[model samples]
Target: MTQMTRSAVGGRLSDDKRKAIALQALARTESIRVLAERNGVSGPTVKMKTCMSRG
Candidate 1:
């Protein structure tokens, strides 16, 4: 799992925020790297979130 941080994007996101991000990942409007960076998380983290949401 990616370490949660408090830099630009801040610490761990709320469940709602995570769900929203997962939805964004599913939308595929942006690359995983771009979405992760924009959200201050790792690409794999976003991927994992997306996968878990599907699960």
Candidate 2:
């Protein structure tokens, strides 16, 4: 298998900060797709971050 580059992991938001931002976006938005697009990240990533924050 080919090795993945660091950029493949996505942008430089830290775990804590990412969770904070994702939560804020979720509160203000109704759609994960819109939030992800606005935040320049993937929908599943935002979902994962939000879920992790809740736990």
Candidate 3:
């Protein structure tokens, strides 16, 4: 599998923050675009977090 590198955004999201984002993403409770925008992360980053949660 390919390594997943984080984006060079303003700063890194804390572990708790990442978990929170991943939870909401995996739960399918909100739109990915909205979540990414609100969290200041790229859409792909959100998807990557959810994918990482799989393992």
> Which lDDT tens digits does candidate 2 get at residues 4-53?
32224436767776876568756865687676665666777777777776
Which digits, one per residue and each the tens of the lDDT, describe model 3 over residues 1-55? 1123325551478888888889999998899988887787877888888999989
Model 3 global lDDT (CA atoms, 0 to 1): 0.78
Worst 10 residues of 1 by lDDT: 1-10
Model 1 CA lDDT for position 36: 85
Name the best candidate (by TM-score). Answer: 3
Better of 1 and 3 by lDDT: 1
Per-prediction TM-score to the true structure, in the order listed: 0.78, 0.62, 0.79
Question: Where does model 3 exceed 4 Å of error?
Answer: 1-6
Q: Looking at candidate 3, what is the lDDT of residue 31?
A: 98
The candidates, ranked best first by TM-score, are 3, 1, 2
Task: For candidate 1, write residues 1-55 as lDDT tens digits.
Answer: 2444623343367888888889999999999888888888777778888999998
For model 3, the run of ten residues with the poorest summed lDDT: 1-10
lDDT of 1 at 11: 39
How far is 24's C-alpha from truth in model 2 (Å)?
2.9
lDDT at position 40, candidate 2: 64
